[model samples]
Target: MSLTLYALGVAVLLSASFFYLFGYRSWRRRRVMAKPFPADWQTILDRDVWVYRHLPEPLQARLRPLIQVFLDEKRFYGCAGLTVTDTMRVTIAAEACLLILNLPLSFYDDLRAILVYPSAYRVPDIHREGEVLSESSGVHLGDSWQRGKVILSWEDVVAGAGHHQHGHNVAIHEFTHQLDQADGSADGAPMLRSSNALRTWSQVFSKAFDNLQKTLEQGHSELIDPYGATNPAEFFAVVTETFFERPRALHREHPALYRQLQQFFDLDPLSWTRAGD
Candidate 1:
């Protein structure tokens, strides 16, 4: 009996070790296989002169390969009588690449493809228990799901690329969701560099999120879209668009939040806008 018990314990330990080793190896392999955008991608992405002109040289260099991978791998379909053009493809690729530039390019390793529609599309509803209920129903301009796909409306993408404000860019919103998912969940928080940074991020975002919710409940004029108050994730994405598009307004109205976002993105759009102005 003693020998049998000892053998059983050893077998359990061996099994646990094997599982751990296998899991770690699988994770490492996936990380290694996540490719960086290729070098010659610019030849293809340069088709869109407008987008190409706006990109900074360093960013352009980094984004070329990523954009190429996006164009090659993703399927872009026209909906609602819309047509896809080189300009449209380049523009969309530029916006998506902006999120990956200056960050770990492999952060999006799991994102397999992007799907674009012509405009806001209606999702189907489900019938439940003799009651016709709107199930999976929403007028979506964009969405990022955990299953390695992102969906967007081309109209919203164009509007976001041009206007940057009005708090309704589906690209920024959905990409933000992608960033949130990098750490394996879409809980409105991305992986931080340090514990202290994480703490500060949580505090600042929580305060701002709560404030936005309060403003929405009170029905007061707000600097940000009220839809942001719907959740922390939405709040981060909404504020991100404002941070980039309407930097002056964001700074003037919510200086603290703006500062936090500046730190998070490591880009000072306010200064950039000011210089441009």
Candidate 2:
């Protein structure tokens, strides 16, 4: 064959291979979503993930496939001799899936593993006491790592998941961190589509976060958790917990903040019926 013709044929073959390589991953995920959701898994979600019960019927249908794909693609490991069960997996996946129900993302594509402890676990953390910086282990209910991991206390998960009105879901809190840390450690803002969106988010979140910090410093804060005052990262996660678990209160208290979350999430959770503990 002519040398030029041979080179053209090789280029065509490489192009086809590239397309197939990427296309196959998308196809595999679709196949995972297509598998019929098991009855046992559905029951687990209904029982543990109270928020799952409140999703709009269409969204509920949309979320199940996401849960399936998450369980399929991500690895889950039990900690402290705890054995990860279907109830734990379904409950955790259900809440995390809600964060991406409307977004055109690959179901937390950067995340890979979820570590669940039976209860509160301790990890290396730092604390400043009396002007002294001390490095020590701190007991935490949950935390997210930018390097493709999330750690949770299953005990807290069950409590937070079952009480939708309390505005304290560890699953939602940690996953929001994952979203905020799209590019790196949680920086209070996720990747926005445009500079205008980023600017708007910055303005709205800054004002609201400032207000929250000031109010918390003065006295007992209600509706929005005081933990949001820790920093912008925690502010984003804490408010996300309030946004989903206590939408009415968040909207009534921080209207601008509520609207910002609504715009980014593309869902007005204000309509969902809040469950009583």
* Top lDDT hit: 2
Candidate 1 lDDT score relative to the true structure? 0.72
**Candidate 2 whole-model C-alpha lDDT, 0 to 1:** 0.88
Candidate 2: TM-score? 0.89
How many times do residue backbones clash in model 2?
A: 0
What C-alpha root-mean-square deviation, in Å, does candidate 2 show against the real structure?
3.4
Candidate 1's residue-wise lDDT over 1-277, tens digit each?
A: 9999999999999988997766654555455336664434344355433334455677567666666655665667666677777656767777776776666655666677777788899976575766655567768888888887888898888777765545566787787788888889777778766889888888988998998888878878788888888888888888887876777888888898888777766666665454432
Q: How well does candidate 2 score on lDDT at residue 113?
A: 98
Assess every candidate by TM-score: 0.74, 0.89
Give the root-mean-square deviation of each candidate in angstroms: 6.3, 3.4
Candidate 1 regions exceeding 4 Å error are 1-56, 72-83, 125-136, 275-277
Native RMSD of candidate 1 (Å)? 6.3
